[model samples]
Target: MTSYNKVNGKWTAENDYLLNEVLKKKWGFKGFVVSDWGAAHSTAGSAQAGLDLEMPFGEYYNDSLINKALQTGEIKEELIDDKIRRLLRVRFEAGMFGPQEKQTEGIFHSNLHKQIAYEAAVNGIVLLKNESELLPIDTGKVRKIAVIGPNAAFARIGGGGSSKVTPHYSVSPMEGLKNKLGNSVEISYALGAIIKNDVRIIENSFFENYNGKKGLKAQYFGNINCEGEPSYTRTDTEVNYLWYYDAPYWDFHGADDSNYFSVRWTGKIKAPKSGKYKFQVMHNDGARLTINGNVLINLWKDRRKSEIDEAVIYLEKGQVYDIQLDYYNNGGVSEIKLGWEIPDTDLIKEATELAKKSDLAILCIGLSDHFEGEGRDREFLILENQDKLIKEVVKANSNTIVVIISGTPPILETWVDEVPAIVQAWFAGQEGGNAIADILLGNRNPSGKLPCTFYKSQNDSPGFSDYQNDDLQSKYVEGIYVGYRYLDKHKIEARFPFGHGLSYSKFVYGKPQYALNENNKAEVKFTLTNTGISAGAEVAQLYIKPLNSQVERPEKELKAYKKVYLRSGESKEVIFELNQDDFKYYDTNIHDWQIDKSQFQLLIGSSSQDIRQTTTPKSL
Candidate 1:
């Protein structure tokens, strides 16, 4: 919309060529195309190029602009009418002009939904390691339990950004264990270290009343340098702000859009105790922070949204210091966040001492919304401050269990061997804590399978820099060889293969058999028997491979999978259906998918790296 050679590398939403030729014409898409904020530039070009709706209230497609263009004959009325028709049809379907259903009290926090969520969490948890059958802790004998780590007492219910939601109730792991064990078992908790390093500075209790005045005094200048008198002066409680579009304070005050603008926030901060406080400043364009008129952190420059600049300052107990921050937005997207951190050093020692005395130690450590979320990418896959915490905890107590609560995989090689048991408890929603406690107490047998492979190192997987080229083209170079396929093809062993999961009980698999029906569909049959004391479920995975093919393909591809539950010593034969299209690969030259006329191999396995049976099927 702005220019072809611009940021985001000419995305299809903004590019006229791809939007018209590929989306509307080749794909025959009849749906409305919505432009993102600030994406639409030209009214005629965007409308003709297939944009149907301008999202979040648009500026270019306003009534005046479109009407002027239509009156001037710059664009046909049919084109404008077509866009409106699509929008009105969607609006009508959504019942925008119709009566809406009213919500009942306590419907959002229903107990029925919470139970369903707990069940889902119980099934989704995967046990990565359980050495010497240390799990299912003997609460009767082990009276003293130590729950320690960053997420030990915190309720990590959801990720950040749009996916984040405030649940009616969220039980922390420490609370869950205590409720499960009761007074018979004594439990203690310790937050060894902070989970996220970039904690925001100006929280609810950041500012103090200065001469009976609350919050910080903010002054907005018309120019970037904050020179002369401010255009507007006001007091604000919160410092962190983001003005992507439709500037709230400026637009209402009728401030100039161009020539850039600056804001100065001044306040008094009283330190609770004598210690070193870390202050962080993050901004899209430029910003600077000062304490007592001393320039400590300065990052005033024309830069994109970047990692925050941090500075540590010593403060005395009950002492008040004047704090000032200056921020300027040079157009485009604007963001500013001022945050501070207070170190909790003594907790690590207390946690170690507690672990040394406890019979069993539960280390709840993993990623939070700040680290992995919807709009943000992970800076590092490894657990933060957990590596050192794990080593320290294990050194004090040999009977320790490492419980990782993350939505994505974290590198566990740092202290995997030190701990006796390891459980991967993903973002388990509101009832995650109770679900994790159930698995620990052996109330539920862990049956969840890994949806993706866990690489030993970040280098073993695909590189992010190579993910996008100089031309901004995202090339899937790995192609069919993603996850376990890539690891298997390259002979790079994974820390845990795709679909891998452990259960309290064990299972044995039998040979697989297949027969082609009249419709040329393959019906695969296999038997899985539970061989352990506990009743559990096993995911039976089936992968297909073309042994002799003209085009290069993965070593194998997962075709079908089913979770089969069996009681102890019980066996069940599972059958799956597969058509010819399941084994076909897309030919780029022909622009169509085609099946090969070569011999195909069928593999049955619990995990990608743990195959149980294999068979060669006749070509159709």
Candidate 2:
């Protein structure tokens, strides 16, 4: 019932929400929400709901789906009217369409958002483990620095979503840090692990069992050659190969005809900066890399007969080196986690050392190539090693700061309390390194909240294993209750609740004023004032549940929410409108959305379960 994002080209689009909610409701949002992948099918209207433009998807506006929606009455023409009007409102608010500020043509493009992204990254970086003051590597003092690790250079950048923009350009951590340190800090590098697991396989199946269902929309490119040749190609058939692409118009036509093909290639990667480093690597299939133009990765490039097992390398500071690897997947599944450890920044090694000099230790641990950014969701292989690493790191160094960078939530229990601080750096785009550095140096206070929940373990989930492929037969097990709702109803506790995050600053919540008109529906107004030194946005969440109902119910569900930014001592009345629809849920028994006409409880809080204020409905 909620929405999920996807990646297409350079931007992220809302495959689910943007069209159904933003466009369907013609929502007049003052602040624009971003899109996640292939969502241009409904982009214009999305922009109307305060989503001015889709990120990285360039400036494309899908007219076909809009025309279809309008022609079939799937959407009303009035929606277009509202959309244009709402976009104008955003334009005015941004001083683009309004008389407030006459903008010069050149001013249309701004880099301020890039800075904002960096700052946001700094704030979101959760300090998971820090012992022996192993951080704040004063750039001025560190003479020889070794930045090693598959992720040290690899940019987990913004993930695959409609927001995924074919960036006009992008920056990786190694490049950014090298630019930051200059020649003062000598650095070494080693891709001790592989970031992307090359999956190659030769297998196909005929769906004689496939019922008459719409197959994958076909868009054939008919095999373009590497040197501009029309090489071998395959035609179409009912193979159900749902080839995913981000291009606006898939202009390929063909019938399913099987064909054979072969491809090859190679490249090199140099340790842009050199210091002291070592490798820790893994892989299920083939791959190759080179240092000093020597193959760091040496594997047979072919089918499933052999896999690129693993490789290691030592790093030296300020020494320019080269790297090259060859990879190809034959079939089935594959896995890889290639990381490096530089003597200067090796948390794992430092944590285990007996002669550590720093007063506090900061262990920067989280989803490396496994979580966040792209290749594939859940492709980052978040396994039991995560739990083990957390516990071991904290046990080795008590005063540790832990940071997690994942697109989704991971279980937490092994070392939550053993560590002093935790930060959630959710795939912050480019300049990720600077963001981490700034946060560690106290340049910013974190204000980002959990967009999803963190469970204590997978077993705590009712149906984690059967969720992906078991569609019709899949059972919610927990019923209508999800996330905080299910936990609250069953009195089950989560490692971290949704919308939970810590800030260096503090805030206060005033009692909410619930009011209604004769129609027995209205919005509740509340005042949220930030009493901290730094400015930040607060995501005020609204949850509702039936007081007395004839049907079964979960705990409270998030009905509506609003994010507001305010300065210290500045106060604004925040309002949340509650309508009949707000109280309704999909009543499958009646096959319609319905709202129970009875007493209701409203829970307002910094996050789910931790209610700071509550109220009983005065009406409806």
lDDT of each: 0.79, 0.51
TM-score to native of every candidate shown: 0.74, 0.58
Best by lDDT: 1
Tens digit of per-residue lDDT, candidate 1, span 1-620: 22223333554455765676666677876667887655676777677777777755778788998888899887899998887887887788888889987867677578788899899999999998899999878776898999998777767786655456556567878878877778888998777766665444354355786435577888888777777888888777667554443342633342467327788989888776788988888676788899999898888887765467889999888898999999887775556778776654465687899999999889998987667765546743666467888899999999999988888888888887778899989888889989999999988899999998777888777655355477666566676777788888889988888999999999988888889867778988888999999899998999987899888888898999999889989999999889978888888897678987778899998899999899897754
Q: Which residue runs of candidate 1 sit more than 4 Å off their true CA positions?
A: 1-10, 14-31, 36-49, 64-99, 198-344, 465-473, 518-520
RMSD of each: 7.8, 14.2
Off by over 4 Å in 2: 1-113, 116-153, 158-347, 368-397, 465-472, 517-521
Q: How accurate is candidate 2 locally (lDDT)?
A: 0.51
Q: What lDDT score is found at residue 319 in candidate 2? A: 47
Model 2 alpha-carbon miss at residue 346, Å: 10
- The sequence of per-residue lDDT tens digits that candidate 2 reaches over residues 275-346 is 544443344344454556656555544433223343456655444343322332333332333334444553
